[model samples]
Target: MLRVENLVRRFGGITATDNLSLDVARGELHAIIGPNGAGKTTLISQLTGQLLPNSGAIRFAGREITTMPSYKRSALGLARSFQITSLLTDFTALDNVALAVQAHDGHSFYFWGSARNEKHLREAARSALARVGLGHRADVVVSELSHGEQRELELAVALATKPQLLLLDEPMAGLGITESARMVKLLQELRQEVTIVLVEHDMDAVFALADRITVLVYGRVIASGAPSAIRQNEEVRRAYLGDQHAVTDHA
Candidate 1:
């Protein structure tokens, strides 16, 4: 469903995405794993149009979107959640999700007042929140929710767009063990419904949820295959997995 070819992005003298090429099939959950400064986020930024690539191409569902703006990409069925929580601190969870729905429908900013009262928007937001296990906390202010809950809310907002591909950057970054497990479970269920490109530090989650794993090092692909193949790859182990081997041993 998604294809990238020879994508390169640079910052001054540093190469952040060095000729990275990858493919994500329809309905597949592809995980991107790498150590810090490995350029995973840079690749994602280029794919999502947050940062235009210095060169190369990105195509989704058969059309090139390399130069599409972020909002246009979102409109074209691509959505992403940041590594850090991005939410309106003062807004209730439902309100935040409702805004996402409004944006997806291309409603003007001036329509928000009436949009909030629209039953369809509220219902859609509520359904998205419920999908992310936040239905009961809809009225809670984002600032009042726990970090894990906030993270889930982020997913809800992304889902409110009804994206065909979901790009999640470290959804488990700051969660507790139980919360991480919950996110994993939610993702496991979600993979059945949509294509996902997960960039995460949690090996357990990557091994548990990814249909295929792609390891990146210094903006280039080091390995790409099924989870088992990635776990067994010597280059992957040495370059990223290190000596833990938990990707194979535990999962």
Candidate 2:
């Protein structure tokens, strides 16, 4: 569903992505794992068109979107959730998702006043919230939601776009043990329906959820294969995993 070819991004003399390339199959959950400064986020930024690659190409569903604007890429069914929660704290969870639905419909924020009252938009928003297990909190203000709920709200906002491929950046970043487990379950269920490219530091989550794993070090892929193969890869172990044998660290 997604292909990145020779993707490179640099900052002055520092190369964030060094000739990185990978492919994500349809309906598969592919995880990108690496240590800090490995350029996982940069790769994601380029893929979503937030940051254009210095050179190389990115294609989604077979069409080149290397130069497509971020909004345009989103319109073409690429949706992402940030590592940091980006939510309208003043808005109700339902309102936040409804606005996403409004944007997906090609309407600008100016039309939100009327769009908020639109039954279809509200219904779509409700559906998205329900999909992320946030239906009960639909009317609650985002600020009042727990950290995990806020993270789930971000996913709801992304899902409102009805994306064919979901670019999830550390959905398990700031959760408690229980919360992380809940999110893992949610993603396990979600992977059944949509293609996902997960960039995460949580190794347990990555190994548990990823159908395929790509290990990146200094912005280049060291290994790419099933979780078991990634675990046994000497290069991956030397570059990232190190002496960390246990992958399941919920705490």
Indicate which candidate wins on TM-score: 1
Give per-residue lDDT, candidate 1, residue 13.
Answer: 100
lDDT of 1 by residue, 65-141 (tens): 99989999999999999988989999899999999999999887785466579899899999999999999999999
How high is the lDDT of residue 195 in model 1? 95
Model 2, 63-135: lDDT tens digits are 9999999999999999999989999999899999999999999876765576679999999999999999999
Lowest summed-lDDT stretch of 10 residues in model 1? 242-251
Over the full model, what C-alpha lDDT does candidate 1 score relative to the true structure?
A: 0.92
**TM-scores of the candidates in the order shown:** 0.97, 0.96
Model 1 vs. true fold: TM:
0.97
Go through the candidates in order and give each one's C-alpha lDDT.
0.92, 0.92
How many steric clashes between backbone atoms does each model show?
0, 0
